[model samples]
Target: MVFKKFTNGCVNLVNKYLPDAFLFAIVLTIIVFLAGMGITQQTPMAMVKHWGTGFWSLLSFSMQMVLVLVLGTAMAKAPVFERLLTAIAMSAKTPGRAVVITAVVATVACWLNWGFGLIIGVLIAKEMAKRVKGVDYRLLIATGYAGMIVWHGGISGSIPLQIASGSAESLAQQTAGALTAQVPTSETIFAPFNLIICLLFLIFLPLVAHAMMPTKENTVTVDPRIFEEPPAPPAHKFTPAENFERNRVMWIITLALGYIYIVYNLVTTNFNLGLNIVNMIFLFVGLTLHGNLRRYIDALMASASTAGGIILQFPFYAGIMGMMTGVSAATGTSLAQVISNAFVSIATPVTFPLFTYLSAGIVNLFVPSGGGQWAVQGPIMMPAGVALGVKPAVTAMGIAWGDAWTNMIQPFWALPALGIAGLSARDIMGYCVIVLIMGGIITSAVFLLFGGMGWF
Candidate 1:
């Protein structure tokens, strides 16, 4: 009862104080800018230049993120996809069951692909909201976002995937030759400790979220009318172009041709999965399931509006990444590097991973990009860990968890899920604060125990 009171208090506080996500980004930008000037003593103009350089840097990445939402939402709109999701949602006959089921499914989906996980969670939540009475809609969306806390430990994780396949040269250069060889997936993603962590979250996060559900009087269920499905397009006689647009056979043939390359690449690349490949899978699956070009295009258009927040917000984050990592000519170190080095300076072997996790979580607030954070911290922490007798994979996983850990409170990544669920970040972030605290304790304990046991 006391714990529930504390959780409810957090929700009320965030709802009172949390601004819109875009404003949060702006405030964060100001904080980083001022911090950079104070910490590095770099001139404001120099910082502005760095910010401007990075403002457009995420154009490609931003598009990929946009497509993750657009494609996943589109795919979910297909009749088959709707039926499958509805069947899964129907199992949750009660409010607690709805929350638990959403968290578990979202966790597994996020493990496969973070982008897909984000959309699927809310879509399932929406379905459950329609069928289940007394489920808190805000908490359901928050549960969807909470699933992302395990993504960095999963198959599609960027840091592990980068090291396993392509970042060796860059990593070597960044670490100043202290590390050279690639760290394989066997040592990172599929490693015993990482798998154990993923399994625990898969088991426990749902329970934690189930416990956080508001009471019947406090619950905020969504209006079912908000999720009314769009009507099917009317049939008509067609011109040549129109006939091509409606042709299912043409789409199937094209999908078949795309899959050949996809299969060939997976075979050649030893089944390595990357963000681009995940997007391709979403695209092909969405196209095939929607049955024809016209309907698929319609699905895509319907889902496109959900991407506005992501589109408007990511470049600012990219610029924030730039400011966080950009070096000062006077100080000769970036703010991110300085923040990392502070934690590294006080570390013993057992505490190295713990401090690294804590520091990564802090740095993640300012530089939320996993790849970007790794670029800044990986080179610094990995080398320091090696000198202290910790393994490279352990150090890398610490950084990965740090990136995923703090995301429970960060509204940037929550944009997609929030947009789909028709809720503001403030509506859901209180439950996420509980998730952030619970997840922090879990991951930190794991790192400490394993670090002490020399289990890594």
Candidate 2:
């Protein structure tokens, strides 16, 4: 009952107070602009210049992010995956089971690819809600978001993968001691400690979400009609061009060609799974699952509006990142330095990863982009980790987890999921706050114990 009250109160508070994501981005841009003026030696004009120049710095990265969400969402809506989700959702006859299964499936998807997990989670929740009567709509959405909790520690975590890739070596140009060599996934994503924490959350998060479900009288449910998917249009006689567009023969050829490229990539790259490759993998898998050009195109078209919100908001964050990073030498200390040093001051061998995690969480709120955040804090944190005797991989993972940790409350990463759910951040975030707290505790304990044990 105490938890129930807290959840309800939180929901009410957030829904009432929080602004739309666009406004939130605008506020962050203003805050960072002012913060740069105060903390750095740059003149107002210089700061404006920095913001302008940096606004488009993430153009390539921004496209990659957009595709991940757009393509993944497109893939999930394909009939093959839809039927699969519906079949699974049918087994969840009770509201409690529906929420748990949604979390489990989302967690598994997120563990594989954050984009995949985010889209699939929302779609699955909608399907489950349609099949199962009486589930709290808000909690179901929250459960879908909650399953993404494990993404940072999962295979597609940005920081961990950044350090693993050859491209991370370019960071040395920015800071004196940023990592100049690749760090392997074995040390971070696949580490024993990380795996242990992930497994525990898989078992634990569902029970907590299930228990948090509101009572029947207090539950917030919408008419199931809202959850209903519109039926696909029936096929009719077609012209040659239309027939060619819908032809399964061409789709089969496309699928075969896509698989060949994917196979060649895996073989030549020695199974390297970078962001672009991951997106391509999703593309092929999505095409095959979708089974034809016309169906796949329809799914893709449905994803555009859901993706456009995130696309519009990312530039503001890039501007903020630019103003924060492009500091004048005369200021004598960068905000990134001050932020990193705050945690570094108290860090020792046993506690370094914890502080790194905390600092990354703070930086993440302001900087938001995982790659962008790392480019700032990574330089400072990487050397500090080596000095304090935390393995580079552990330190890297610490930052990765920290980046992912605060995302439960950070609205940027939730854009895809929220857009698909037709809800705002407030509808889902109150429950995510609970997850943020639980994940922080579990992750911190694991980091400390493992660092002490020399596990990773």
Candidate 3:
């Protein structure tokens, strides 16, 4: 079909032109640094210093992201995980169905918990790649990530949940109360308008991806050898040390400890499903299913390659984040301030939600974290929303989706899925660009429709 040809053409073009993830990060770093120099009065040396100070700023976050890829890949290697994934993959009778199923399952899982959704999406899509003959490896991964595109609309959506739980102290402090105190989940995450937008993406993204499957002759399937499982660690003549390494009791004990911790947190604190907790869950799940220390270590080694791009490049992005969003020790003007102020100047009261969404999308390129981005943009956009007579909750959701929308192209979020799938951003970003365009249309239409209804 013409559609398939166009999509395939796009893919080939990307494969020809797109660079590796590390280079992509470097290029983004250069661009942001230049922008910082142009937009702010900071000296080049000062900007470089800021970049240096900020390079390690994302260490904790980098570790969290690394774990998601590392542990998630290790978890997928377990015999139990692989079997479960294979069983589900087996249900898909054709290549297109595999892509569709992965997308739907990923979207729904992401709706419940973003981390769970993330790991599950990549794991399942990898399974499908291993099991489904002739599935385009890149398209399968793209479909999995497409499911993640809906995470901002899900229960774990950071900005909406923050506003819903009335814990937006950071925003309030920054904005001096330009944002209201609390706008319940009813007006944000669970809003009927938001739900309609979420539903459309959840249903349509997979179908669109399915439709984009390349012609039979042009389909690009990866070699099965790439996903082959590693051999279980060999046992020599019986010894106490070997027995200790091979025993399941230690694994079970460790698993029990993790479960106890999870229970204690859920009961005494709250359902703390942040990246750390989720990473812990992935760790324990990997350990338990892997069955023993030696086997787990082997599985870990097998998937360790997946984390290289993420590990090498996160610091550069952190540096870029520093220059663009961090206040200069001298000049004081941030690139984020300039870009956001420009948008703020042009936005009308009634049209601000759409601007909020678009502006968030722009800032999201430099600042990828949902909470971090909200902190930077919320103060400015939220106050403006109120002045323009926009609903606080709607303003909040608009920013949320904007953050999610740009994620499709940002290599930051794609690291985990790529690590799992053994693909680079260049392999799938072309397809993701298509998804991003579609997502923008859907998000823009929803924002406009509600804006017209005076639902601001």
Candidate 4:
């Protein structure tokens, strides 16, 4: 009875505050502990090693975050860019339509860079909300962020994964060689398809939400103050040199890229240094680029503050991966058998992609990071696809589709979106839920059709 009471109290407290963090900690701890106990195939020490791996992984995560903040801030302050984004968000009048536009814009930005995508989408949604009255701003914000989920599936997303996979230099060379192989590039074709699908989504989503809007015609009161806030002043207010120096975040990303360039060239040239040593050098450079000793102290604190949730969850995720990998290694075809059995049971070939899409969507709930999810799921799915006679790229695309569509409703990405828009999930839930459901259905259908026809 005492134990039950303690558990209930803990649950209630967690439900009220830090729900995501609490859930991550609990799930990860249970998984890691079980793996450690040898209840799963993995030994505890393997899990420990995985946790140690996070020390390096977290640095990459930090680099991505810093890049996101700098790009976001740049987009937010750029007048021409801001106007273009706002126009995109406001293109569709209905809340659902607005969300589709937001998602497309976000996805495109994410394709270029995930961090920039989040910043631009959130900023645009916020601006649109300020201009329009009675619209659900939260939904728009969620829609904008949804685009970020698929970034890892795009061409640019391949780079970091290649690096982590220990194939970065080779992949970079291969990509460069393939650059001139196509007229417009594969990404160009995919971009238009994505845009068209988003347009279709915007058109249909409003009809779905029409039932939810207030029925009676009421006086539309437009706030004059909405129009009164002048546009952001010129960039001259902050000089170019000051902009570069003040935003240490940008410099970190630049340095990281430089490090990547050096590593790529060195590896291709058959240089001797290990990948670990290269990463260490980059970490040192990241630390040194901050300049002032005091600033480094503050940055350490700031980084910890921002990464608290991520750090807390790392052990558990690592544990889960350890257990899963162990199972795969021991059972030989066990994982493949399970997936193949699932695939065989599906009625049609189209159903296979649909299943892949839905499976990816479910995974996104727990693993929100696109690159991370790919790291975890990619290997499993690749062999599973071979066993099931599905193309690996098609399965990969399905994973991407699933990752992108669910970002609409997931609170992980929504926090930044909400922060920028001054809205809550509750405020946006009504509209975002509709977009999510619709987009998920549409995206799944697209994947299924493409996979079945071998169009991907």
Provide the RMSD of all predictions against the true structure, rounded to 1 decimal: 1.5, 2.4, 2.0, 10.7
Model 2 spans with C-alpha error above 4 angstroms: 167-175, 178-181, 231-235, 451-456
**Model 1 residue 437 distance off true place after TM-score fit, in angstroms:** 0.5
How far residue 400's Cα lies from its native spot in candidate 2, in Å, is 0.8
lDDT of every predicted structure (CA atoms): 0.89, 0.81, 0.83, 0.50
lDDT sort, best first:
1, 3, 2, 4
Q: What lDDT score goes with residue 351 in model 2?
A: 90
Residues 1-456 of candidate 4 have per-residue lDDT tens digits of 453344234333433554353364466446544644453344566555544554344455544444344334433443455576567656767554554555566666665655556667777666656655665544456556656655554444542333333343543343332211222223322444444554555455434433333322321223426433355356667677655666767656756776787778668845423333333443444445445333344444433333334344444444444333333334343222234335436625456657766766665654555665555455555455556676444555666666666766555555545544545444454455556767877776666666567665
**Candidate no. 2 TM-score:** 0.92
Candidate 2 backbone collisions, by pair? none
Encode model 2's per-residue lDDT on 175-199: one tens digit a residue: 3565677778888888888899899
On the 0 to 100 scale, the lDDT of residue 305 in model 1 is 93
Best by lDDT: 1
Better of 2 and 4 by TM-score: 2
Which tens-of-lDDT digit does each residue in 1-456 have in candidate 3?
787777877788888988887888888888888877777877798789879988998889888888888888888878788889989999998998999999898899888888888889878888898888999888888888877788888888988877765555755775559754767788888898889998998888888889888878878898878777556457558689878888888877877999899778767646746678888888888988888877788777877877887788888888887887767655666888777778878887667888888988999988888977887787777788788788788888888999999999898898888877778888898888888888999999988888888765
The residue-level lDDT of candidate 1 at 378 comes to 82
Candidate 1 Cα lDDT to native: 0.89
